[model samples]
Target: MKIRKANQNDLDEILNLFTDTISEVNNRDYSPSQIKAWSSSSKDTDRWLLKIREQYFLVTEEEDCITGFASITNEGYLDTMFVHKNHQRKGIAKTLITALIDYAKENQLKEIITDGSITARPFFEKHGFKVIKKQMVNRKGIEIANYKMKKLL
Candidate 1:
């Protein structure tokens, strides 16, 4: 797999990956209703555009297809990290996260933060992120519980 900077052209594929992975892989941890509410298609186009345009988004590609992606805001916030369902447990997410952290370090960012889902909290914890708080985020009127985690760079 190769990691590279994401362009606007990658937005559609990234959004699809995000939706698919969340609905599939994240189902192991979240309920169906929570998944549907969290990854609702109604928010895709606009949010995808914003993430692609404003954040430092990176994609992992293999055989010309994007298999995973991570996006970090300029202020060192880890906005999103998702890997394709079929591509899970192969270190793809770790690689993408390592690249994002490296970018943060290079840019002199002081800290990195993410609102991590149950499926992702362990990964962030393994990477040295400490839980700051447990948060119940309302998505489409459904309360989704997640951890607010942070790592000092």
Candidate 2:
């Protein structure tokens, strides 16, 4: 798999990856309504473009298909990170996070933080992120549970 910076052309694939991974990988932990509320697959091109431009989004692809993605901010907030459901536990997430961590180090970021879903918290924990708190966040009037996790550089 090759990890590369995202371009405008990758929007559709990115959105699909996000939605599919959320539904398939998170269904075991989240309710149907919660997943729908969270992913909300309605394509908002402008919003996605903004994320692509500002978040320094990156994607990993194999056989011309996107396998995973991760994005981070200058402030070291890991805004988005997802691996295709079928590609989980294959070091994709780790590779994504490792790239972000390297970026954080180069940019002098002191730590990295993210609100991780139940399905993702364990993965982050394995990467040295500790849970700061558990939170109930509302999305589309649906309450969803998550953990605010952080890792010191």
Candidate 3:
């Protein structure tokens, strides 16, 4: 797999991966309605465009297809991380996250924070992130459980 910076042209693939991962992988932890509410963010084209244009967004590609993607802000906020549902446990997330962490370190960031879903919390914990709190975030009037996790760099 190769990791590279994301471009606007990657938007459709990234959004599809984001929605698919949440719908299939996260469904184990979230109810169907919650999944619908959460995955609905795929329609937020402007937000996705902003991240692709302004943040340190990266995508993992293999055989000309995007397998995973992630983004981090200058302030060390991990904005997004999604591996294709079919490509889970294939080190896609690890590679994407490692690149983001390296970017943070290179820029002298003090820490990285993210809202990790129940399905993703373990992975975050495995990477040395600690749960700051468990919070219920409302999406389309549906409350979804996630952890506010942070790792000091």
Model number with the top TM-score: 3
Model 1: per-residue lDDT, tens digit, 23-123? 88889889999999999853658778878889999999999999999999989999889999899999998998899999999999999999999999999
Looking at model 2, residue 123 earns an lDDT score of: 91
**Tens digits of per-residue lDDT for model 3, 1-153:** 999999999999999999999988999999999999999989999999999999999999999899999999999999999999889999999998899999999999999999999999999999999999999999999999999999999
Predicted structure 3, TM vs. truth:
0.99
lDDT of 1 at 49: 82
Candidate 2's error at 69, in angstroms?
A: 0.4
Error of 3 at 140 (Å): 0.6
Ranking by TM-score: 3, 2, 1
Q: Rank the candidates by lDDT, best first.
A: 3, 2, 1
Model 1: CA > 4 A from native:
none
lDDT of each: 0.91, 0.93, 0.95
What tens-digit string does per-residue lDDT give for candidate 2 at 1-153?
899999889888889989999889899999999999999843677988988999879999999999999999999999999999889889999999999999999999999999999999989999999999999999899999999999999
Q: Cα lDDT for residue 19, model 1? A: 89
Worst window of 10 by summed lDDT in candidate 3: 15-24
